[model samples]
Target: MTRKTLILIAAGGSALLMLGALGFQYIGQMPPCKLCYWQRYPHIAAIAIGLVALWLPGRLLPGAGALAALTTAGIGFYHTGVERKWWLGPESCSSQPITGLSTDDLLSQIMTAPVVRCDEPPFVLLGLSMASWNVVASMLLALIWLQALRKS
Candidate 1:
């Protein structure tokens, strides 16, 4: 495919994922946790990078887009591991505990705890949670970005 077509595809793919995330949150009633939100940032960045690449002659934008994809892929992997109980997630989200807390600290923790957590898998499909799907999809995006770079 041409570089322009590739950029458009990459941007459109990210847009679709963003819209899907919104649909999940608003229509499907699945509130995103902290890590889930983190995974989205790269996609948003990639969409912008793709747009810029469309107007530029250099390959830097596609490379940047690849980096964005990779960053989100890493987040997705971390989130998947957290959801699968393979590792601890963020202190605010995971149930790893805020150890050695005093009475006041415990009260603060209770009051400030997030309603949704990064470690909990709110939805799953074919034994894979949303995070896992994100990892797979984001990696695919990285491949697409690489192809765009090659073409450029």
Candidate 2:
């Protein structure tokens, strides 16, 4: 296939994945955590790069798309690590110590806490959490982007 065609396919795949995520969040009522939301940005960037690659006459688009894919993959990997307790995630969304808080402070915290957290994995498939799957999928998208780059 042509470079443009390949980039289009990669972009379409990313778009579909994004739509599926939104569907799960809205229709399925599976709200995304902080880390989960972070993983979507790179796909958005890749889609934009794909649009540019489709119309622009430059070889750099594919490289930019590849970078975007890799960026998401990195975030996914970090999120998976956070979910698995390999490391701490964002302090704002992850668990925090509240052992010594007053009653009023505790109540305030309960009212202000996020509905979903970056340290928790709410969905899993075949022993892999959504973050893990994102890592794999984003890596695949990166490969597709790289292939487009090679073709260019």
Candidate 3:
């Protein structure tokens, strides 16, 4: 495929993923957790890089796109781990220490905490959570970006 075609596939994939996430949020009524939001920033960056790379002639932007994809994929993997209890997630969205807090302080913390928790998978398909799917999709997009880099 041409460089432009590869770039389109890579960047368009990110767009589609974002749309899916939004659909899950609005249509499906599934709210994203803190890690879910973290996974999105790199996809947004990839989309912008892809748009600019379409007009430029260099491997830099394509490489940047690949890096963005990889970054998101890594976050997705981390999120998956959090959901699976393989490792701890951020204290803000996951479990936090309550050892030193008084009853009132604990109540305040609980009240102020986010409604969504990162360690719980709100939706899963084929035994994989949305974060798992993002990792898979982002890795594929990264491959496409790498192919575009080769063409450049």
Candidate 4:
């Protein structure tokens, strides 16, 4: 396929993934955690790049789209590690120590704590979490972007 077509496909892929995520969150009643939310930003950026790539006459935008895809893929892997307890995650998203807190303080903490967590995957398929799937999809999108670059 031509580079233009590849870029369009890659961008569409990102958009579809983002839409699915939103569907899971809003329609399926699954709230996204901090890390899950982090994974969306790059896709949004990539979509923008794709839209601009259609009008632009160079490879810069498509290259940026590739970088965006890889960035999300990297975040997905990090989120997968956090889900599997392979390593510690950010303090804000992970459970924190509740030691030495008075009853009222503890109550307040629980009430104000985030409903979602980055340390666990809310949905999984065939033993792979959403983040893992995102990694796979984003990597594929990245490759498409790379192929577009090569063609140009």
lDDT of 2 by residue, 73-97 (tens): 9999999999999999887763557
User: Which parts of model 2 have CA positions greater than 4 angstroms off?
Assistant: 94-114
Model 2, position 59, has a per-residue lDDT of: 71
How many clashes show up in model 1?
0
Q: What is the C-alpha lDDT profile of model 1 across 50-122, one tens digit per residue? A: 8888999888999999899899999999999988889988887534456899999998888886589887788
| lDDT value, residue 121 of candidate 2 | 81
TM-scores for every predicted model: 0.85, 0.86, 0.87, 0.87
> Candidate 3's residue-wise lDDT over 1-152, tens digit each?
99999999999999999999999999988878889999999999999999999999999999999999999999999999999999999987745456988899999988987589899999999999999999999999999999999999
lDDT of 4 by residue, 6-110 (tens): 999999999999999999999998888878989999999999999999878787888999999999999999999999999988887745567999999999999
- Winning model by lDDT: 3
Better of 2 and 3 by lDDT: 3
Computed on alpha carbons, the lDDT of every model, listed in order, comes to 0.87, 0.87, 0.94, 0.92
Comparing 1 and 4 on TM-score, the stronger one: 4
Candidate 1 ranges beyond 4 A from true positions:
94-114
lDDT agreement of model 4 with the native: 0.92
As a TM-score, model 3 comes out at: 0.87
